[model samples]
Target: MNYEGSGHGLARFLAKARQGQGFTVGALGGSVSIGHGLKRGMRYEQSAYSELNMHRIVFDYLDKLFPAKNGRQIGGDNTKRGANRFVNGAVPAIGSDYFAMCFGHHIPEDVDLVLVDMAINDGFSEKGAESYETLLRHLLALPNRPAVINLQVFALMFQTIATGGDIHQGISSYYDVPTVSLRNLLLPIILQNSSYGISYFDHPPGTTELDREGLGTRHISAKGHGLIGRLTNAFIDMRIRDLVTGLYGAELESRLVPETPREQIRALQRFNTYEAIPAIPPKCLSAHSRSPTLIPSTNKGWFKYLIADQPGSIVSFDFVTAGGLVQLSVYRSHNAGLGTAACWVDDMKDKRVIIEARWDDLVSIGYTVTIANDLEDGDHVLTCELLEETKDPQKKHEFRIIAVIR
Candidate 1:
């Protein structure tokens, strides 16, 4: 959690907040950001079904500390339930590709502060990185240039190999955006067998030793949420205090990031600085992949794509992208019924990639996989065909495409 200068977008929020103006705080990301296992084992007498997430805690603090004199809220209702507006646009299993493709529908336009947490969900992929950059650009290009913070939440998975974090950190550094690292704050404690780290996280029954505690592969416990929330509030309070003290001088914000000497070299070598450009909201072809045309699914949303189990069934899409990245979103789950599909660009069947729909997870989620990258900035056609001929009879023989992102 580094200071992003007095020009931080959040400073505007603090200013408006001090003036008694209504403010809205919004969030977007995957399962962790939305609190998946949060209610499983409640603590401190926390409500089982309450919207008791870390962001919600932040919202509560803002509502009380900076009360709007007019009592105006984004809820637009006379009630105080949603005063000083809070929008939760997070989809549990979706990645940045899907979120950037459908940003307009999810995020509120009048939001003063936006929290984006894609640290763990965006598995290492160039498409994920591009979409994240595009999303940040859109947030920065907003009419008011509302404050956007990149909150990279980490789990025990970081102890192993890379989990799409390096790319995210590099991108954040390049943009010099206001980003926070939960991993940096907590990882060392778990590594050193510290006592506080063990208390902050929950483990299986009677699993006490830190070395034996499987790197937090599961959702963090309620107390973990509380600590993070309190810490975040503390950070915000410090910034608010600075805003009130005239510490944010007229100096311009720094454009480069990762102020270290080695990091500065990497930041300068990059040819294209993605500081310009707006969001590219994709044409969501949910259940229409088989029909070879864009159509609404019976499920009636871009969040879910449905494909029938038929051999040689094909879904085709033609798109033009200046960024030269094509992404395919599909359902990967533990279900045996999910079918496999072959994806290719520009009718080049020779370079097609075989995508297996089955995953070891217990739940079904919209997972984005890169179909093609490093293409020319021109017209391209993407083809996906279902290969249903398998020896397993109980197989679902189904493939779902959440969206086709460019």
Candidate 2:
């Protein structure tokens, strides 16, 4: 497999990591990174579902390349150990726009390398480009200056050599970071082998089958994921060697300037940063019929949150700073009872912004929704209320409050 994009930053980091000077690695992406559809062992607390995802494969490779000195165990079990640490920060079905709000707080400050594998989840669009660039700049600007590699894992149906692959290339070009496209690397091999009997572009082998809904959709099988992991490891090895031996220094240096210039980078850095806003708990507010109740979040690690399923349930908070942009952390689910909520800021009673509190799948997960932007600097009040109920009587429409940021 061939390595795509610049390798200067990645090479510098890998050289140190390869020599037993361990470093922490982090990943940010969606379901593919979460090992969706893979088999899991009966053990309830495995780091991943039977270790079938890309991040797991990369971690294994790192362990072998740089063996741990003390043989520290990972995930509180002796099943895995390595000098370097790994953080699988990927959340299923999330996009780059929600990265900072959802998983930013959890990422380690001393991260040395980050793998961004969100091409399929992000789709191919201009908004995807902006969000992708925003995520890249945020990682680069970190105090440690961690190296980032865009690992684009895709299926033949959702992405091809031309569509999602091209979009990722454009974004990577702007950041001067290394990128590895599974579409470009794996598709050619699959296409040449007639034994696989795959004639149509969309009907790639081991990618489509009858899922729970009896519909033919694209999902990489376990074997396919392994192939991707192997290809990525090979690409990393090649790039590291090239960079360390000074074979590609000039080409790598040329990428630092980006194709569009520095203005684009500056704009993204400014737009992505925000101050964390304090959320006022319901108990602090005056007792009212619509006040939401504080309860433990069904989505673990979120601590206690305010949740209400009844229509007209209200959660309000105040902000006393110069507000340019505000984000509301919410919970979304595909359950039939989930409904929608309306948000109002300050005296904008007539301008109620409706937010859908439903997802396409059964899993309940945290999401960040931007409620307001470009607000005047001063005191401001925000109110969120359940506006409607789902049609299903068994399921109740609910909204969860996680955090507020501006």
What are the lDDT scores of the predictions, listed in order?
Answer: 0.63, 0.58
lDDT of 2 by residue, 71-90 (tens): 53343212233357776666
Candidate 1's residue-wise lDDT over 131-183, tens digit each?
A: 67766666655555667777766665333435555577777656556666666
Among the numbered candidates, top lDDT falls to 1
Q: Could you estimate the TM-score for every candidate?
A: 0.71, 0.71
